[model samples]
Every structure is written in structure tokens, then in C-alpha cells.
Target: MTAPTPRAILEYGLSSGNVGLVQLLGLCPLLAVSNNAVNALGLGLATVLALTATNTAVAGIRRLTRRDVRIPAFILVIAAVVTSIELAMRAWLPALHAVLGLFIPLIVTNCALMGRAEAFASRHDPARAALDGFATGLGFLWVLLALGAVRELAGEGSLFAGAGHLLGLPGLELVAAGYPGFVPAVLPIGAFLALAGLVALRQGWRLRRAGAGA
Candidate 1:
């Protein structure tokens, strides 16, 4: 099949082709660090940076890469990009970096990033590959942001509790100070439940669209 147009690539990444919601890749970090909005945002930004850089580098060097060594080469490129981002974050945003510690380095192992490098970037030009990476990363970012917001609000009765420190935004508490938070919403089980709901919702929407078109 022919590759999607640039606009389609961007649109799909934001919606139907979301790495988190649709492809369902890289759920370990997605679930682990999304307890709050600030952590989610921090990790999401790092993923975006890593994905974009990896795709660009892979696409730029596709011709020079031997088919047999492509997988390892792609992994090396991804590792280098992730390492650079991780180091930069550690230097500039130590607190946020510390908060997202293991996950930052784990970006190199994210199948979503690897999938894009091998499937799309390897076949496309650098400009298009970069766009795909950005779009794909943005898709993953929004899901993390939404899930984190939901979990935080449900579990802590507030949103962006540490935004002032990590993301430089004012923290907002929607509920009274006395509000008893939902313990389950911030737990590992909660991540599974929340992601299930989102996946279901997406599938439902797809069904509706298919029915309408049919």
C-alpha cells in the first residue's frame, strides 16, 4: 500500500492512529508515570523529542543503512536520540527528569518509536519522516495528558497538583481540601481500567463512523 499523505499522517497521529490509544504501544511508561498531569507532560515531551529525532535520523540515513543491519542501526539511532534527550532533561529540568527517571531512558525501547523508524521513516524522506514522528508523538502526548488529568482529578480531587514546579503552571484544585480522593484511580489497576475505557470509546467511534459511511 502507498504511504499516507502528509496531512493524513498528521491527522491519524492525532486521532485514529494514536500510538497510545490506537496502536496501544509503550503502555508501561504510559501507565506508570501518568499518575498526575505534570509527570505525564514531562514524559510525553521527552517521548515526542525522542520519536522525532529517531525518525529524522533513520530516514536521513536509510540509503546508507544495509538491510541486514537496519534493525540494530535503528535501535542505535533511537538509543542515541533518547540518551541525548534524557541527558538534556537531567541538566535543564532536573526535577522533572528525576520524576520520570527510568521511563526517560526507556524511550529507546518503546516499540512505537521503533515501529515508526522501521515502517515509515525507513521508507520516507527525512521531511516526511519528521512530520510522521511529530504527529505520532503528539498523538501519544495527548493521550498521556488526558489520562493523567483524569487520574489526578479522580484520585486527588485536583488537577496539575505539581504543575508550578514541573510544568511552570498554576496548580488548580477543583474539589474542596477535605475531598476524599478515590484511591483506585491513581493505582496501577486504575491505569488499566482507564485505558480500557479509552480504547472502548475509540472503537465505538470507529464503529459509528463505519456504520454511517456504510
Candidate 2:
């Protein structure tokens, strides 16, 4: 197998290795908070901040950390970063923070962050680790946004329905006033179906690319 180039490493989390659609990491928050675009964006940004900071911190102290204590050290780093983000949100974006609720604190439990710290940040320089975290976070963000948009549009006939809380802007209503939205699209089962659809689309694109190369 060929070793990953810098470009591949940088883009991995955002494309083929997306934590949401590809790796299915952090599904609890991904599904729970993604009922609308604004919530998804809020959570996504928080996750990004947590991941990038934790990865950088881990990489910076990697040499100092003993092998036996590395896992605990990484968890502490991740939790601290996440706690900072949660506090900032509580102070600045209280409405969005309330909407996200327990999920914000739950970011500490996201396996994807731990996976990156152990698999990439520990082995790479701080710059590369930060990039990986940002890229991975972006990958995760896009998936959340897409899933949220689809579910919101289908269920509520609108997009960014809660934007006033996050962005201070009213949401857009795509359908007529009388349009009866599909209720199931915003339910828990809808998240599963929508995510599956996204995964299938990604797989189809990959198949086409492979065939073209062949």
C-alpha cells in the first residue's frame, strides 16, 4: 500500500474518512442536534474547536508524555478543550447552548477526537496535527449541515429554522405557507435514513472514480 501524502492526510477527514458519514463517529450529537441547520452548525463549530485545540495540545506535549500515561493525558486535553468551548457558548450563544444541551459536554466522549489524538497527533508535528483536526472537523461539519438541511427541509419546509438563535437571522421558508411537511423526516429514524443516503452517494462517487481510473 502506498503511504499517504501530505495532501491526502490533510483532506482525509473531510472526504473519504468523514467522521459522520464514513466513520460514523459522534452519532449521538450528529443525530440529536441536527434537526435543523442552525443547531447542526452550532454543534459542528464547537466540535471543530474542540478537535483542533486538543490535537494541537496533544502534539505539543507528545514528547513529554510517558507512553503509559498517554491515553489519560489525551483525554484530559480533549475534555479541557471541550469544556472551554462549552463555557464560551454558554456565555456568548446561550440560546444555541441550551438547545444543544448535554451534547456539548458529550463532545468529550466522541471517539473521533480520541482517534485523531492517538493515531495522528501523537505521531505528527503540531501543525500537521492541527490541520488534520481542522480538516476532520470540517468533514464532520459538512455532513452534519447536509443531514440537518435535508431533514429540516423535508420535515418543516424550511432551512435554518432556528437561525435567530445562532446567527440572529430569520430562517428561510422554501415551501408555500400551506405546505404540509413530512413529519418523519425530522425523526430519529429519519436521521438514519438520511445518513445512509449520504453514505451511498459517497460510495457511488468513489465507484465512478475508480472505474474512470481503470
Candidate 3:
């Protein structure tokens, strides 16, 4: 919550929104869409857009919005941005939109967005709020991309398969034959396992960093 310097904000977003690290605030989409790279990337991008827009809006209106009603105001801002994004995705990326389904609209409820708006955006200037939102979104996107790649590779024996459907490219899909498919990697349980491993790795890195600093 203490997002000050640009570097600090970046680190905060990266560590907190790691999806596998300390702040697992937004898991619904993370777990659901992470089964494939395209879906993960799509959702991640949407979240980034939402967070950035909402944060900026909230920051700009902080003085106008009263404290008691700020949360609702923030949600409304986020919902508007998310709705616009959802519509655009549905029109242009219909296949990906359908796959994301209800979760696409549900980005309104993502705590990470609201949390940043209320805690960071409301107090910070527009510039800082935007930076924080983008940094945080990048963090979330990083996790999604990594998880998606891992699951897609392990479960489908291919990487970025059917990417053309999302990218509008005819030959974007690629395949690898060597991966003996593991069905579990694409399952919900697999998400948990993969996230756990990622969390452990992050914690270990932090410990090493702390020791070196000491």
C-alpha cells in the first residue's frame, strides 16, 4: 500500500500481484484463463487497461468524491472502463471474449483494481496513480503470461496454439511434439500447483536478496 517512488511502486506491483506471491487478490481470472497463453494475455491486457483508467479517474476526482461514497464511485469508474473493454473485445476478438465469458465483465469486482484506486490512487496524483496501475498490471500480466505458457506447454504439447484466433494472424499458432501431455497441468488443481511453485521461488529470491543486503 505504501507506493511512493517509481521503483517502489514497480516492486510493489510486481511482488504483490505476482499471483503466486504475497498478494493473491485477484485469483478468479488468474486461475481460469491461465490454462492458455492467448486467454491469459487477453485478460491481463484488459486488467491493465481497467486499472490504469480507473486509477486515473479516481485520482482526478478524489477531491470531488467524499470518503464515505468513494468506494462506489471507484467501482463505477472501473465498471465503465471494463465495459468498454469488454465490448471492444467481444466485437473484435469474439472467440477470446466468449472463452473469457462472465469473467470478462467480472473484472469490475477485481479487488486489485479497487484496492489500488482506494489506497493508492485516491491519495496520489494522476501521474503516480497511472504509473502504479500500469506497474501493477504488468505484474499481474507477468504471472498470467508465465502461468499460461507453462500450462499450455505442459498440457497441450504446444505453445501459443490457436494464437491466430486472438492475434488475427493466419499462422500464429506453433506446435512442439516433444511434450508428453499432462492433463493435470491444464486443470484447476494444476493452477494451484504451479502458483505454489512460483510463490516458493519468489520467497527464496527475497530471502537471498535480504541476506545479500544484510
lDDT of each: 0.89, 0.88, 0.86
TM-score of each: 0.94, 0.94, 0.93
TM-score of 2: 0.94
Candidate 2: count of backbone clashes, pairs at least 3 residues apart or interchain: 0
The regions of model 1 sitting more than 4 angstroms off are 1-3, 171-176
Model 2 lDDT per residue over 1-214, tens place:
3445668976788887889988899999898877888888889988888889999999999999999999999999998899999999899888888888999999999999999999999988898888889988988899999999999888888888658656677654244477698999999999989988998999999999999999
Better of 2 and 3 by TM-score: 2
Alpha carbon RMSD to native, model 3: 2.0
Displacement of residue 55 (Cα, Å) in model 3 is 0.3
**Tens digit of per-residue lDDT, candidate 3, span 19-74:** 32568878888888899888888899999888888889999999999989998888
For candidate 3, what is the lDDT? 0.86
Worst 10 residues of 2 by lDDT: 167-176
For residues 80-183, write the lDDT of model 1, one tens digit per residue: 89889988888888888878889899888889999999989999999989999999999999999889998988999888787767656664434448879999
Candidate 2, residue 199: the lDDT equals 88
